[model samples]
Target: MNSEFTIAIHSLALLAYRPDHMATSDMIAHNVCTHPARVRKVMAMLRKNGYVAAKEGTGGGFILKCDPEQVTLAEMYRLTSMGSVKPGWCSGDAEQDCMIACNMATVMDQLYAGAEKQMIDYFGQWTIRDVLEQVRREQEKKPGV
Candidate 1:
């Protein structure tokens, strides 16, 4: 659970709660208890992925670009990660593979690929709406006014 993933998901969930409203980075940072710059960077990535829309000038902020039900967690995770992970034990380099010649490498490769696939598949099964609903349920469970 990297901060990026948590922040991205939290941002998306917040946007989903108010799809038509543009939330400023400062507001989002306040909710996440992080710096505004970090929120802005995450917003940039979300905007680049077509997951969010930003407006400039007065009342400028970010809004959800698509329906929460249409946006899978996997897509959000992929956008946040920027496709950094590869589909093997090591990156695409012949020399590295040659140097680590052993069955362990092959086994590790399968394990890593499987883990990545599982993550994608799990997130793919849920949408931002699901996350928000879970939050709501947890809030309901709390004993407070």
Candidate 2:
């Protein structure tokens, strides 16, 4: 997985925590430790998908448009990634004729598919609310938190 998945989750969690407040992309980028443009891109995608609502100009930003508990991590993953998720392997034409390379590629492809399936299933089991609870619990366990 790439940063988009984590960023989307973090962005949504921030919105979920501040349900009544609007969060700018800059604020979200600060929290996610990424570029504001990336956050804006993700936020735009989320907004287009009806997961968030955006407002322009002063005192305007983004807010969650749907219930956190109703949105699964898998949904966020799919939305932010836009269904372009792929295996972490590169296959060139030169290696296609090699029996060993061909076999390994096939095996790796299957493994990747299995791994992705498990990950999607795991994501399906948790919502943004559960993630927030986990974060709060961890923070409370910290020495100064």
Which candidate should be chosen as best, given TM-score against the real structure? 2
Q: Pick the candidate with the highest lDDT.
A: 2
Cα deviation of 114, candidate 1, in Å: 0.5
TM-score of each: 0.82, 0.85
The segments of candidate 1 whose C-alpha lies over 4 angstroms from its true place after superposition are 82-101
User: What digit string (tens of lDDT, one per residue) describes model 2 on residues 31-95?
Assistant: 99999999998889899899999999999999999999989998987776533445555463335
Model 1 C-alpha RMSD vs. true structure (Å) is 3.5
Candidate 1 versus the native: TM-score?
A: 0.82
**What are the lDDT figures for the candidates, one per model?**
0.82, 0.86
lDDT of model 2 at residue 119?
A: 78
Worst 10 residues of 1 by lDDT: 82-91
Q: What is the lDDT of residue 22 in candidate 1?
A: 89
lDDT of 1 by residue, 20-80 (tens): 7889999999999999999999889889878889998899999988788888888877776
Q: lDDT of candidate 2 vs native?
A: 0.86
- 10 residues in a row with least lDDT, candidate 2: 81-90
Off by over 4 Å in 2: 82-88, 91-98
